[model samples]
Target: MQFLSAYAAALIVFGILDAVWLSIMGRLLYRPTLGSLMLDNLRWAPALVFYFLFPVGVVHFAVLPAFAAGSLQTALVNGGFLGLLAYATYDLTNYATLRVWTLTLTLVDVVYGAAATAIVAGGAYGALRVLASAGWI
Candidate 1:
């Protein structure tokens, strides 16, 4: 139950933050360079898949570990590293193989991913701690 709550909270936080970032900055940043590859219309299926699955990865690789250890600091560092790795795997692969990919986009995305994940994990962990203390967990 605790793990489930933490996962749910973290997913919500990440989804909201990413949506804002993608809307305000991501479209402008990627469209110019990857215009040909960018979809003309949003595809709900794949977008939803990525968004949902990505948080699961964070929960498994980062959040759960910190929660198990009872260390919010662990979540911060591990979550950030996990996010960096996850984003780098995609961005770096694209930068290497995709001619349209740019360093600017890659840097921005990886950095954003790391920061966002760290914040989400930390916030989720703190919230869970509060809930547990209040006997709400």
Candidate 2:
């Protein structure tokens, strides 16, 4: 039903976008394992948690299925703002010190966060518009 499609859409968008970002990260600075990955990724996690949680994920997957219909908006305003803020902070911090490790991690966070927000929001909005036009709203 609607629940399946909504979850499908969100997962598809997030997965593809995160994959691309992770690819870029791996190419540039290599990948971290275990705890280090978590530490490096923290800068972006707050916004991402919101992006996936209590969002279109909630509205589309839960509310829509319950009503046998619904609308979907990715709510990107906050996501974009947070991504930008975190990127700027990381950039400034990295610039001042520019330690190889720190710079690498911050760069990864900045790029990944921005790209993730743009791709996820853009993908979701496009899908929502398509669904809306198809009367899947």
Candidate 3:
């Protein structure tokens, strides 16, 4: 139950942060290099589903341990590591298989994913602590 709360909080916080980042930077970062292969319109349903599911793994493997350790640093480091692994898995696989995939995009995404996850995990931990203090969780 506690984990579920943490996950939900993390998802909400991270989703908002990610949405802002994408809205501001996605086109500048991706459209030029991959325009030919880019879909005319994004399939938002699956993309949103991916956002929902990916955080489950992030919260489970990274945030939970950090909470146990009682350290924000742990959350940041572990979350970044896990995020790198996850993004690398997706980006590398696409890079290997898709002719349109660019190394620049892959590298940029891996870095962004790591940083974003670290920030989100740390923020989630802080939010959970605040909630617990307020007797909300």
Worst 10 residues of 3 by lDDT: 123-132
Q: How well is each residue in 16-77 modelled by candidate 3, as lDDT tens digits?
A: 98999888777898887788787888899999899899888778877788888888898899
Report the C-alpha lDDT of model 1 over 1-137, residue by residue, as the tens digit.
87788888888999899889988885679787788787888899998898888777777777778878999899899889988998999999999999889999899999998999898888788877888899998
Candidate 3 vs. true structure, TM-score:
0.91
lDDT of 2 by residue, 62-137 (tens): 3343333332222354345445565667676756765344655666677667656545544555565567679986
Error of 3 at 109 (Å): 0.5
Model 3: pairs clashing at backbone N, Cα or C within 3 Å:
none
Shift of residue 5 alpha carbon in model 3, Å: 2.0
Cα-based lDDT at residue 92, candidate 3: 96
Q: Candidate 2: where is the Cα deviation over 4 Å? A: 1-8, 32-77, 85-100
lDDT for 22 in candidate 3 is: 84
Model 2 residue 57 lDDT score: 42
Candidate 1 lands at a TM-score of 0.92
Question: Which candidate model has the greater lDDT, 1 or 3?
Answer: 1
Worst 10 residues of 2 by lDDT: 65-74
TM-score of each candidate?
A: 0.92, 0.50, 0.91
